[model samples]
Target: MLYIGIDLGTSAVKLLLMDETGRIHNVVSREYPLFFPHPGWSEQNPEDWFEQTLAGLEELVSGADRDKVAGISFGGQMHGLVILDENDAVIRPAILWNDGRTVKETDYLNQEIGRDRLSEYTANIAFAGFTAPKLLWVRDNEPENFARIRRIMLPKDYLCYRLSGTFATDLSDASGMLLLDVKNRRWSKEMLEICGVTEDQLPQLFESYEKVGTLKPELAKRLGLPEAVVIAAGAGDNAAAAVGTGTVGDGRCNISLGTSGTIFISSRQFRVDSNNALHSFDHADGTYHLMGCMLSAASCNKWWMDDILATKDYAGEQADITKLGENHVFFLPYLMGERSPWNDPMARATFTGITMDTTRADLTQAVLEGVCFATRDMYEIARSLGVHVDRTKICGGGAKSPLWRRMIANILNIKVDVPACEEGPGMGGAMLAMVADGVYATVEDAANAIVKVRETEEPDPELVAKYEERYRQFRTLYPALKPVFQEIAK
Candidate 1:
């Protein structure tokens, strides 16, 4: 038997085919356009997502044994708002997770309604990117469209509906919507009232590994598969990536350094920080996890290297950065504002302490160190909550860099384990499918059986000490510049 994993990403839909034994047989990707109608707004057509995914699925199983496919699951971009009309047609372009157009709505929730109440209701504070705020924005700015909404879906849930003909979402993905009572694993009634939505407007909820429904007959026929193909309710990208790294069970940790950086910690018990610096969400493994998300991670490096430096030679540029934690320059990794801890959309990236004698290598090293220090900020928050993390599995593009991995290990003073398979969320999605197919009894069982670590980067005490002093300084820059960022935005 085989399983399929669909990773519905921001730029593309990635499909993976794997057998019951966890061996990947084929992978396919299809790119789609991301639209920006305003400076801070991001949108994508839901139709484009379904079409590309359909096309990609056809290509994914073109030369494979389609009849043996047992189940399909997903790991997708979370918190994007996708509304449908009575006819089940997309009402408008989806407002994406990175979209920052909900400032007014976010303020209304966090300040006017109060963060304490919001956190109590949802176990998370409002961010501009959450689906609830986006709904409020739509209600206030596009009342006509809001009036026509019959269903509210997340990005991947829209695909799930198209494929399985079921309107459903998994706990991990729904948790980020600021609509789930994560502590209770149900929709928050207060949030529904606050957003002017009802229970009927939301999709049915399921655990990440639970089967939602079988594939639609038409879709099954088009893809040359059986109509009995199970559709598993998958998880948010971060949680799925955690599963892919085998970061399940209590005290497990995974760090992803993709376009956005996230520090994900899994726990058997549900816990929310007093300040709500980290998001308390349901895990894909039927447990719970805390996540701290940074808006820009490797994208900051891409901006500095590709946009500013005009070089695609990331390795070539880093080759000269031999000096580890002794740089005089400091960088704030706030290229796209920031989240987790600060939640400031006005924050801007900056390089401080650059002297005329500062070399290019010094600035480049600062960029990498800045991201590591920012990660440590989240790690510190986790420690403050008594979630002791001695080590973390590392994934994403930046994790591929030995220098960045070393920096993370030393700065956070933990062992950074590199996984043998770095496919991230897509691989995790397939694992969930295996669980749904009964090939594995539990998510943890599948993870334990399949996930493997290739190597570990142990922290150096000397380097850790140097970074400790540097991080002290790095932490001060953001707070000091808060007013400045606010003024510039105004």
Candidate 2:
């Protein structure tokens, strides 16, 4: 049997076709536009997502054995607010996860309502990117649209509804919405009341590997697939990426350095930190995981190389960065504000300690090191919670760079394992589909069978020691600049 994985990303929908044995047969990607109506606000049309996904699926399965396709699943960008009217038509453009227009709503939740109550209700506090804040924003700013809302859906759930005619979401994705009692894996009643929404407005919840419904006959037929094709409940992008990298079971970790950077740690038990800095969310594997997300990572490098330096030669620029841990210049990787430990959307990127003697290599190296240093901040938080992580699997675009991988391993003082297949969330989505199809008994079984390690980068004591000192200084810069960032934003 064959399985299909759809990764509904911010810029594009990536589709993957895989066989029962985990061999990828075909892959297709379709790009869509991201709209910004106001400064710091991000939105996308749900119809664009469905249309692109439909077209991508048609292309993905074109040369494959259509009759053998058994299931389809998804991994998508989380925390986007999609609403539908009574007629099931989209009410408005989706407010995306990267959107930062919910400052007022977020402040109201974190201050007026209080973070303690929120953490009690949902096991997480309000962030500008969270769905609860977005809902509150819509209610306050667009009351007319809010009045028309019949259903609330996340980005991928919209696609799931279009494909399977089922309004459903997986635990991992719902956990990020600030509407789930994550510790218990259910919608939080208090949050529903707080957001002025009812449980009926939300989608039915399922574990990521569970089957939601069969594909709609029209969609299946259009794609030349069987009507019986199972539609598995999918996961949030990071959790899906973790599954693809085989970072399941207790003590497993996966670090993703895409546009956003995330440190994902899987656990059999549910745990939340004292400060709620790390997200306590349900895992795609029917367990639980803690994640720390940084708003910018690889984008920092992109900004420096393309926007600042006016060149697309990322490797050419990085080639001169031979001095690993001794650069005097330091950078703060907060290009799009920040999340995780800081949670400050006002924070701005800075290049500090640059001397007249600083070379281009020194500045370039700082950007990479800054990202690694921020990653270590999350690792320290996990360690403080008594979750010992000796190693982590690395994935995403930045993981392809050997220098960045080495920096991550040394700076975090952990063994960094690289996966043979780095398809990230798309691959994980297919694996979930295989589980739903009964080709694998469990998510863990599917992960263990499919994920293969290509190589490992072990931390060196000398390099680790140097990075340790550098990280100490890097951690202090954020606090020193906090008030400055706030003032500038005002």
State the displacement of the C-alpha of residue 10, model 1, in Å, after optimal TM-score superposition: 1.4
TM-score of each: 0.99, 0.99
RMSD of 1: 0.9
lDDT of 2 by residue, 1-490 (tens): 8888999988899999988788999999999999999888889999999999988988888898899999999999999999999999999999999888888999999999999999999989999898999999999999999999999999999999999999999999999999999989999999999999999999999999999999998887788889999999999999999999999999899999988899999999999887989999999999999999998998899889989999988899899998788988999998878888888888899999988899998999999999999999999999999999999999988999999999999999999999998999999999999999898999999998999999999999999999888888898899999999999998
* Candidate 2 clash pair list: none
Which regions of candidate 2 fall more than 4 Å away from where they truly are? Answer: none
For candidate 1, give the lDDT: 0.94
Per-residue error for 256 in candidate 1, Å, reads 0.2
- How high is the CA lDDT of each candidate model? 0.94, 0.93
Backbone N/Cα/C clashes per model: 0, 0
